[model samples]
Target chain A: AQTVTQSQPEMSVQEAETVTLSCTYDTSESDYYLFWYKQPPSRQMILVIRQEAYKQQNATENRFSVNFQKAAKSFSLKISDSQLGDAAMYFCASSAYSGAGSYQLTFGKGTKLSVIP
Target chain B: DAGVTQSPTHLIKTRGQQVTLRCSPKSGHDTVSWYQQALGQGPQFIFQYYEEEERQRGNFPDRFSGHQFPNYSSELNVNALLLGDSALYLCASSSHMRLDQETQYFGPGTRLLVL
Candidate 1:
């Protein structure tokens, strides 16, 4: 079984600044994927960015980037030049490479991010 | 393209009653997955349906059942609903059952209130 953990319950960052949300997971599988999802006040879950375990280089999506440390089982999301619109509940998810629709995802508790003006 | 959609944006029901939520997968998508998200918590996988059959399920009880139609639309049925069951129910759809790069696109979700 895979378990994802987000130690930070809440985080805040000033406008134009940057914020990093921490995430860790426990899994025996060597090949997998990690994702960061954002849920705004609208209650819609939006995919932010994704990282493939096979890729040593982190993934970057404009203002969103990730620092994926496979050895440490850590995958953190970094929001650059944070804007007020970035304020939301961020969840970290892990998915193993498998069939049987076992491609299920294990998610962390989430970190509530607040962008300050 | 039309994204995944869920019907009855909000619903209210009394305990011990039954409720059914519906979902339509994204255009060209054949797989539908359901998730439950409680307040202040991340979404938990409920089940996935493909070919009008349940392909995988999470740890939820049997009281929580579902169905998939030939149109790729799905329904989640919860019997003897409890107050604890009140939460946001999300529907996601993916293109295929492939082992790699299978990203699920989610709907806005239906908010269920078990009074």
Candidate 2:
């Protein structure tokens, strides 16, 4: 079974500062996908970033990036220039192929982020 | 374009009752996946439906069931609902034709509260 772990239950960052959320996953599949999702009070799960196991280059999207250490089985998300809008629950997830044309995601408990204005 | 959508944004039920939640996939997407998000926790996968059939499921019990229609929409039916079944149910959709095969986009989710 694929499992993802986020040890941090809560974290806070000053506005305009940066914060990092830690996540680790275990999977036997050599080729899999990692993702970070953000859910606000409104309850929508938004895609934050994505990383492929084969890619050595860390995945980044504007202010959001990931430090993916394949050997360590760690994928942590870093948010630069954190704004109040960044305050939300962040979840780390992994997807592994179950069968032909099918993939299921396993997610961590999540990290609650608060931005101090 | 309209994104993934779920109906009955909020529901209240009691133990031993049954509830059904619905979802409509995003445009051009044929696969739908369901998840259960407990309060203060991440979402757990329930199952996935494609081509009007169940293709994959997670570690949930048989009480949690789902069905996909010919139009690629889906419904999740929970029988004998337990207090633990109360959570935010999310629906995600992805297309096999996409380069990133598992790039699922999620809906706002339906919040179910069991008394």
**Number of the top candidate by TM-score?**
2
Model 1: chain A TM-score against the true structure: 0.96
lDDT agreement with native, every candidate: 0.91, 0.95
Cα lDDT of model 2 by residue, B1-115, tens digit: 9899999999999999999999999999999999999988889999999999999988899999999999999999999999999999999999888888788999999999999
What is every candidate's C-alpha DockQ against the true complex, given to 2 decimals? 0.67, 0.85
Winning model by lDDT: 2
Q: lDDT at B9 for candidate 2?
A: 99
Task: Pull out the clashing pairs in model 2.
Answer: none
Name model 2 segments beyond 4 Å from true.
Answer: none
Q: For each candidate, give its TM-score against the true structure.
A: 0.96, 0.98
Summarize candidate 1's per-residue lDDT along A64-95 as a digit string, tens digits. Answer: 99999999999999999999999999999998
Best by DockQ: 2
lDDT of 2 by residue, A90-110 (tens): 999999888978988999999
Q: Write the residue-wise lDDT of candidate 1 on B82-113 in tens digits.
A: 99999999998886745443678789999999
